[model samples]
Target: MASNTFERFDLESSQEWKPYIARFRQYMISQKCDQTLYTAHLITAVSNRVYKLMCTLCHPNKPENTEFEALVEIVANHFGPKGSVVAARYEFRKREQRLDENITGFIHQLQLLAQRCEFDDKLEENLRDQLAAGVASDAIRQSLFMEKNLNFTRAKEIALNMEAAANTCKIGKENTIDNKAKINTSSTKSARRSSSRCWRCGRIHDEEPDDCPYLQFKCNICTEKGHLAKMCPQSASKLTPYNTRKREGYVKKRYHTRFSNYFGSDSDSGSEQSEVQVIVRKKNKKRQLRYVKK
Candidate 1:
């Protein structure tokens, strides 16, 4: 095995002395180190200042001369007193999932906190209740509430699934909103282009329609000198909504003969005349009825 297994003791690190020492023992076990040399290894693992402090703690007796358990106890006492049982449990119970923490991290944090709490055989039960009670998501919490005979495994599974699904949905919704905003922006650009587009020649520029670049452009189809082929009134293939215009002329009011759809001057269709006008041609100058079919 390689020489370096465990890192040196770090008081400034987030890991407490107890957990650090526990991990050091596991490392020693993995290395198949002799139990008698554990105290010696522990002595070298600490920093210079820590080794001096340990020597002082040993007093007349040398650190290497002591038992492993005794040296550990001495070091632990020097570091800090054991925490209260009530305080540890209170801290464990109060721990809720933080806003930036994910489900896996939150559950791991709970497990760490539960170590100090002496729930014994009811550890799983306490964990389950605490997880359900203090979950960050209300949907997960409520699902746990409605769940029948919810255990730690079941509760954790449900909470994780719910959290994952909610996150995916939130991402999808944000992406959808972004896509809609982009489409709206594209449509706005298109509208601006159309607004500045010239109807006479289909050229786009920031100018009025009458001041278009094609003011003197000739029409290819109609041979018009002042308009393009698309804007030529004589073009038969130019039927479009823009080409259709409302006529403001009035139709001549006249009576149609009901004899055989002939245009005379009287009819039983109605007595009151509508505001209709029609152009008539003079033939014999006696007002001859001209029958026109639409």
Candidate 2:
């Protein structure tokens, strides 16, 4: 075979000897290339750097004269990386199905780890145990654990079938895969506005807003139109001295509030609710009075 026909081996690159030689062997078998050609094929396919190194290694005898099997064995022994058995086994044991990965992909990863681990006669048993213990789905793991005489092949079969069935069911039931968290907004939204704070005027309204003493309502809290200082959003977010301090110490607070509806249907009714009362207190503890209308 021509040198360019196969990938050139460069010691500087990440190219691995095992896979490179495996591919060459496969091509040779398919082409029915003679065993005699294998030695020449390997020598011809390597880069100049590798070839020069091989020449030095062969010394008095040329590399071409070197037996193909001996040449391959010599090069592999020189450059092929040695793997740690314990490390490989640790990785194999730690291998679990990833969130986005399927059972097949997970199993393929396990198989790769198994090759490096050298489980030998117990390879199947080890694979079976890892598959059962490390499957992503609790149902699949439980099923495998409960199965009688579960082998590697049987575990793989069960996992694939379960995965396919789950995917099919999900596809048929819209695209949603898992539940997401949400706020309990219904409980909060359904709550009614208390009679203490009026929307039109600032005070607690006994009934309708149209009867509010301050019909041209403007909130002092938010400086907004159509709402009272008591109904301001800015007023609602933080604890006001009104409710926080006054209501907290119901007995000690010298502050007193009178409702707009405190007066009867007598002539003082409209004048009474619309009465603007002033409170004298510390600037920090200051609170605006709210009037309730019809």
Candidate 3:
């Protein structure tokens, strides 16, 4: 609704700078660039030059944050018609300090001016008045010093507004149904038939089965229709070579003692000694008897 949305930053009083700056600081804080974000004066100088060129092309009745098309016109006028300002700014700023305070001040002033005009109000009037009064004019002219009065606070406020607008405009994914992969009743059968085709064998099949032409091995080990080899407890063990089915009758090793459940009747059990005996007889009629396990 407002073509001149950027005109609100100009203020008629120097006192307005404080509130303006406060708002800008708030914006910078919100953007998370309050202290962390820093740029060399070279880039600032170039941007300043480009912005000036753009302003000249627009010839706006007053300071304003020009639209994209206006900016394009300015850039075209600079490079395509008038001359290349980028090269000049680059050449000039290269000799200056990268963090030149003068450059920073100029950058800040331009931003303040832009901010002053970015909204649909007379905020720029105050800024223009301060400029005309020559108060801190040198600082404002200095690209580095101008940074002190940035309009980040207002910009951040504007950003927040834009973010809120975006949120309102958003169609949340939770509520929206994804149309991708949606099936049409007419094509259901065809889609399914096409998808069932075996990609590896290039064979069109309705299913994945052991008898499928794409089947790999013919060994019983590979047959899992009635039983899987790994799951077949009766299968021969590679470690023993004995079929587990055949070894079913064999007793597994038992850890319990045969006499463990048979407790002695009295203290006589302690004195009682169990023994095993063996006898050896030689051809010379010599006999030997050995008793063990006492």
Clashes of each: 7, 3, 40
What lDDT does the true structure give each of the candidates? 0.77, 0.75, 0.39
Q: After superposition, how far is residue 224 of candidate 3 from its true place, in Å?
A: 14
Q: Please identify model 1 stretches exceeding 4 Å from their true place.
A: 1-79, 197-216, 219-294
On TM-score, the stronger of 2 and 3 is 2
Candidate 3: stretches off by over 4 Å: 1-110, 114-159, 164-206, 209-294
Candidate 1 minimal-lDDT segment of 10 residues: 238-247
Return the TM-score for each candidate structure.
Answer: 0.49, 0.49, 0.16
- Mind giving the per-residue lDDT tens digits that candidate 3 earns over 1-294? 112112133323333423543554455455555242211111132335444554566675322444433443454444545434455433333332223333335335544444423333645443333332322323223432234444534433333444455456565542343433344543676668657745334456665544455455323554544333443344433223222222334322212112321335632454444332222233443545343322
- lDDT of residue 293 for candidate 2: 41
Residue-level lDDT tens digits of model 1 in 167-216: 99999999999999999998887788667757778677765677777888
TM-score winner, 1 or 3: 1
